[model samples]
Target: MAQAMLLSLRRISRSFGGIQALDNVSLDIAKGDVIGLVGDNGAGKSTLIKVLAGAHDPTSGDVILEGRPQKLSPPAEAQRLGIETVYQDLSLIGTFTAAENFFLGREIAIGRGPALLRWIRRKSMGDTAMRGLEELNIDIPGIRSKPVDRMSGGQRQLVAIARGAFWGHKLLLLDEPTAALGVRESREVLDLIKRLGAQGLTIVMVTHNLDHLWQVCNRVVVMRRGRKAADLASSATNMEDVVAYITGAKEPMTPRPATTEAGA
Candidate 1:
């Protein structure tokens, strides 16, 4: 049976001055989907992600989330709606511990007669962070106290993802999650992503690494020149076919063995 639809992009389009970054692209993301967004530079992958993250508004189109239309702008609105984005930069404070970074903006406070007089709950935050990581089966030693800068690249990425997973209840968007990690670290990060999916966290990932995408994503969405070129089931298509779509060597057609009720 097909999964229930989580989000629908209705003829989404975006333009930068005269340049069209996205042209009437429509997509449906189902619950528990791990969609891999792939394309070359200038393919509008980043712009599309920003649109979903509420960082950029479509020039014309609608975003429907769980059957209700939304105007996702200025980012905070998206966060409130349970959509979290982890960008390529990771956005962790190098000097702060993992627990601190996990609750950077949304910290727990106690005895708050006034906002300024309230005290932050350090131990509670650390214990909660540790529990969340353990639930994801992520074994990062000293994650509660170690500074993100002191950890390895892969561990840092995992920490950022864990933070997103903790807060984002509906959707998690990741941009080039394993971009600069070593082989071992990349493997660890991929394993964590798989674990998140197994726990029913819907995810959309943007990455240049096709191998990594195949490992974690159940579906692939290919973009070319600011438009969706192809959307296919990862198990039904090969890397060569996906590359062909990305390079414009193959035209967009109805995907075989459609993975979603909306049909690719």
Candidate 2:
């Protein structure tokens, strides 16, 4: 049986003034698949992610979700569709606790009407956040009381991932999640990603770490100079081939087996 397509970028293109950031790029991402997006500095990897994230509207293209056309021009629209992004900044308020950061802007209101009468349901939010962490089998000590800035980098990243997992129903976009971590911390984050994948979370992770991609990604997409250079199955390609694609040393060939949906 064919795996269902979760998201598709159809002939997407983005331009700023005369410079093209993305040039008619297209990609099909299947449900429950982990995709590693790789590229050099000038590549459109970040631009592509922002397009999907609703941070940047594509100059020309369509975003298809589950066979339906979706206009993801605004960030709110993406959130309404259960798509969430965890940027490199972690986006957590340093002064806030893990639970507080988990429910950041979208707080749970207890009352139905006016702002004066409606109160923030802090306890409810904390309980729900705790439950979510527990469900993901993630352990973060002092999540309810300790501030996020006081936590380790790995712990903070995990909190961010947990928040995304809790709210994101369809897709999770992670940008350089393990970039600032130590060796052990990086492994921990990678393991958490693998666990999420196992539980059927569709993830698009942007990373320069080829070894990390080999460990968690089912498919790797390489981009260069505003275009998609190659897409290859992790099991069928190596770091050298991926590097070659990024550096434009070799042309992209048809992906072997095309997609990883069957094994995804």
Candidate 3:
């Protein structure tokens, strides 16, 4: 049996005034697959990610989620549809505890009837947040009430990922997840990504590290000057070839023998 496509971009294009960030780029993302989106600076990688995350609406073309067209307008809408993103900033409030950060905008509320009658369920929120992190096999000592600012870089990244896992029922997009991390921290993040994939969560990670891609990604999509330069299976392509595509040293090609879960 063939693998099912979870998301599809058909002739997607986005422009910023006179600059075209993405141009007629078509791609398909399979269910339960970890995809690496790689490109040089200003290669439209971030733009494509924003388009998928509902942070940017394409100027032309369609975004098909599960075979149906969707006009994803706001980031909230994307989250509602089970698509979550963890950008480079992580977006966690430094002064906020892990639980607080986890339920930043979507806090648990109790009581009913009048708006004033209801209150934020603090205890329930902490319990649920801890439970969610544990479910993802993320081990963070004193995570429940600790301020994210006090945690190490790796711990913070884990918290961000834990938050995404708690809400991401379908897909998770990570942008430069390990960009600022040390060696050990980077390894931990990569391991967390692999664990998420093993649990059947589809993930799209944007990174410049080809080594990291080989660690977890099932397939890689290379972007060059606002186009889909290369779509190759991780097992079928090497770092040299990927770098070549990113630098425009070689022409784009769709390499074969992809993972069983990747139909592309």
Q: RMSD to native for every prediction?
A: 2.5, 2.9, 3.0
Q: Global CA lDDT of candidate 2, please?
A: 0.89
Runs in model 1 deviating more than 4 A are 111-115, 254-264
Tens digit per residue, CA lDDT, model 1, 15-134:
999999998888889899999999999999999999999999999989989888989887999999999999888479998999999999888888757778878999999999999888
Q: Candidate 3: TM-score?
A: 0.93
Better-scoring candidate (TM-score), 2 or 3: 2
lDDT of 3 by residue, 81-180 (tens): 9999998885799888899999988888987766677798989999998898888788887766789999998889989987887798899999999998
lDDT per prediction?
0.90, 0.89, 0.88
What lDDT tens digits, residue by residue, belong to model 2 across residues 134-203?
9988888888899999999999999998898888888999999999999999998999999999999999
Clashing pairs in 2: none
Model 3 stretches with alpha carbons more than 4 Å out: 112-117, 254-264
lDDT of 3: 0.88
Runs off by more than 4 Å, candidate 2: 114-116, 254-264
Q: What pairs collide in candidate 3?
A: none
Per-prediction TM-score, please? 0.94, 0.94, 0.93
